[model samples]
Target: MRKLPNLFKFDEISDGDNDFKQVMVSILKKEFPIEKQSFFDAFESEKYKECAEVVHKLKHKIHLLGLEEGYILSANFENQLVNNSFELYEDFVIILETIENFLKNI
Candidate 1:
């Protein structure tokens, strides 16, 4: 697994409301895997536009997780997918996996 960056934007945004934080985390834990699988399926099928759409959805989660740089990369990758490019695919996958591992441990 890649190194998890020290991210707490979600914590800051939740305003110390543990209940609200838990709800948001729960939503992410449930939704992320489904979006990830959709991304993989679209990628495997060579549906670049569809892949872009999934990335679009996932990028919001990236931002919510306090990954400012990752969010920018995701936005760029989303655009690349729309243009049928795979140049940043590996880097983007690393971000996804990092988030996956973080969510699992949380």
Candidate 2:
């Protein structure tokens, strides 16, 4: 598993506004799990198009979390999903799990 970066981008975006940071984190806390489930449901059902859509949403989260490499991985995975290819599935799952654990301890 790759080491996840600190939320520096999020901090910078929040611009020292703690309320803004909290709100952003709150949104991520609420959305990531829901989106994660949606991705699983779509992937398990072989609904590649749906998976792609969820991944598209997830990519933004990846970017927001300062995960440039993860964002790239998800972008490739999203594109591959269009052709029903899940070659990067496990790698993407690692990213998801990394984020999940990070969120939990934060």
Candidate 3:
């Protein structure tokens, strides 16, 4: 079986010259939360309006960043939330955590 590589390996969120980790760090610094905690906390409330908005903005940026996988994952999250599908909360949380962890490195 062929294993797929992590799709967030490269992007244009920051200067193209910078590598993956650097670009992620740059994005985080520019964004509200440079770490995972704030990112998670944004979705930890009933007023998930901000979360949805961020997802939308990030979804657009992800394409420019060339991170279709993350964009797709985030879109699913937004979709489920918008449609009141919280049954997969735990599973989504795992995916979100994985995204945050991946951002911690390249």
Q: Which ten residues in a row have the lowest lDDT in candidate 1?
A: 1-10
What is the C-alpha local distance difference test score of each model? 0.89, 0.93, 0.54
Predicted structure 2: clash tally: 0
Clashes of 1: 0
Q: Give the residue spans of candidate 3 off by over 4 A.
A: 1-16, 19-25, 29-39, 58-70
List model 3 lDDT by residue over 1-106, tens digit each.
3122253544333336567656565665466233234445667765466666665665554444445565676688777767656554565455545555554564
lDDT string for model 1 (68-101, tens) is 7889999999999989888889999999998898
The numbered model that scores best in TM-score is 2
User: Regarding TM-score, does 1 or 2 come out ahead?
Assistant: 2
* lDDT of the structure predicted as candidate 1: 0.89
Report lDDT (Cα) of residue 1, candidate 3: 31
For candidate 3, the per-residue lDDT at 99 reads: 50
The candidate with the higher lDDT, 2 or 3, is 2
Give the lDDT of residue 24 in candidate 2. 89
Candidate 3 residue-wise lDDT at 44: 75
* lDDT leaderboard ranking: 2, 1, 3
Query: Which residue pairs collide in model 3, if any?
Result: none
lDDT head-to-head 1 vs 3, winner: 1
